[model samples]
Target: MELFADRAEAGALLAERLPDARDPVVLALPRGGVAVAVPVARRFGAPLDVLVTRKIGYPPQPELGVGAIAEGGEPVFDLALLHRLGLTPESVAGVVEEERRELARRVRAYRGERALPPLEGREVIVVDDGLATGGTARAALRAVAAAKPARVTLAVPVGARGTVEALRQEADEVVALLTPVDFRAVGQWYEHFEQLSDEDVLDLLGAA
Candidate 1:
C-alpha cells in the first residue's frame, strides 16, 4: 500500500525514474497531469505543454466514462462496453461533440495560439496522475504517435499492474512507480487526490 501524499511528491519521485533523452518535451494530460509534470519538466529542462483529452462518459451517468477524445484524434470507445450498454458511436454522437468542444476550449485556454511544440525526432514524455482504465492515456498516446516523435513515454506515479502492462504497447515506455496488484481506483493510492481546477492547471503551466 504505497500511498502518495500529493501530486507534487509523486511527480518528484517519477522525475527520478525518467531517462535522459535528446531534446525532450513533457506534455501533460491537463487538469491533473500538469501538477505531476511540473517537476519532470524541470528535471529534463523540457518545455511543459498540455495534451487535452476529454472523456466521453455514459450519457446518463456522466462520471462513467466509455471513451475519450484527444486533441488531434477521434473519439475512442470501448466497443465491448458499447455493445453491453446497447449503444453505438452514433448514439453517443452528442457526448462526443460536447467533449470535443470542451477539449478545444481547454487547448485554447492552455496553449493560446501556440501549437504543440516540435515533437518529431524529440523524446516526448506524457505524464498523468495515474491510469484507471487507460482510455484517456491510449487516446493521447495515439495522438502523440501521429506526430512521429523519436519516442513517447507515458509516466505515472501509480497504476494498476494490468493497466500498466496494457499501456506498454501504446507507449515506448510506461513508467509507473507503484503498480500494485490490488489496485482499484487511482485515488485510492493517494492520500489527497483532490480534483484540480482549470486555474490550477494554468498556474502550474505558468510556474513550470
Candidate 2:
C-alpha cells in the first residue's frame, strides 16, 4: 500500500492539481478531514469551513453505515442495506434521532450560530481524509448542493477504487491522489492514523 507521512503532506499534494477557480471554498469533513484540509485551504487561498455529517449505522453492527445525516437534518438512506438488515422504520428513526443530536452539537461547537457561507454560483470543494463506504461524503455533497453551488468537487488523498468511482456520480468532479484496488481501510494508506477528538476539531476550526 502507498503511504502518506501525514495529513499536511497529503493535502499539499492534492491541492497542487486542483484548478484555480474564483470564489472557491474548501469544506472539510471533521474530524480527520480537517487535518487533511488545512494545507489545501492554505495553498489554494480559499476560505475553510466544516461540513458536519454523521453516519447512521446498523443497530447490531455500528460500524456498518446504513445511511448518513447531514446538517439541517437532511438524511440519505441506503435502502438496500436497510432492507438486507431488516431494519424497521422505527429503528432507523431512533438511529437518526441520536445522530441528529450529535450533528447539532458538532455544528454549534464548530460554527457557533454562524450561518454557512453561500455557495450559490461559487465553486466548492469538499475535502475528506479518505473515503471508505462513502456515506459521509454523499451526505456532505447533498448538504452543499442545497446551497446551489455552481460546482461541487470531492477531494481526497486516498480511497478504495470502487468507492471513489461510486462517489463520482454524486459530485460534479472528484480528485483523488491514490485509488488502491486492494484497499482494506483508509488507515492503511497513512502512517499516523490517529483519531481526532472533539477538542481537536474545535481547536483546528478556531485557529483557522
Candidate 3:
C-alpha cells in the first residue's frame, strides 16, 4: 500500500505515533535501526544506544533467516521453519555459532566494553527498521528482558502483521507504524533502503 521514502521518514512517522515515555532509553538494532531510532530518541529526550543481534540464516541461502541470537542471549529459532526445511537445531549448530561470533564482533565494535544502561526501572524502547521474520527482534527483546526493565517496547516502522503480532510475547508493548498484509520483504516498503555501514551507524549514534 503505502511506502516510506527512507528510514528517516519512517522514523519520524514512527516517533509521532510513539507513546509518552517516562524515563526512557532508546536502544536501536543497528545499522538501519539506528536511523529509524534517532528521531524517536529525540522525541522522548531519551538516551540512545545500540543493541547488536544477528540472524542465523540458512547456510545455503544466507538471506533466508532461520533464527537469531543477541549478544549475550541464547539463540531463538522458528521451529516450524526448521521442521519444514528438514533441519534441526543440532544440524544448524555451526550456523548458530557463526552468527554468535558475528554478534559478538558487532557488540565489540559498537559498544566496546560499555554494558547496557541500567534499565531496571525505565521504559526501554527497542527500535528496529522493520520486521520480516522478526527473529532478531525476538532475540534482542529477550536479552533486554533479562536486564529487568520495568517495561520493554519493540518499535518498528513497518512489519509483517503476523510477525508483529507474534512479537507481543517478547515485549511489554509493540509499536509498528505499518503492518501491511502483502509484506514480502522489508525493502519493498521503502524506496531508498540502502545498505548501512558500521560507520554510518556510528555517525548516527554520535549525532544522537
> Which regions of candidate 3 are displaced past 4 Å?
none
* Highest-TM-score candidate: 1
lDDT of 3 by residue, 58-126 (tens): 889998988888876788888999999999989999999888788878888888889978878789999
lDDT of 1 by residue, 84-196 (tens): 99999899999999999999898989889889998888899999999999999999999999999999999999988888999999999999999888888988988999999
Per-residue accuracy of model 2 over 83-163 as CA lDDT, tens digit each? 888876567898899999999999998889997788889999999999988989998998898888999999999988888
lDDT of each: 0.92, 0.88, 0.92
Off by over 4 Å in 2: 88-90
Query: How many clashes would you count in candidate 1?
Result: 0
Q: What is the TM-score of each candidate against the true structure?
A: 0.97, 0.95, 0.96
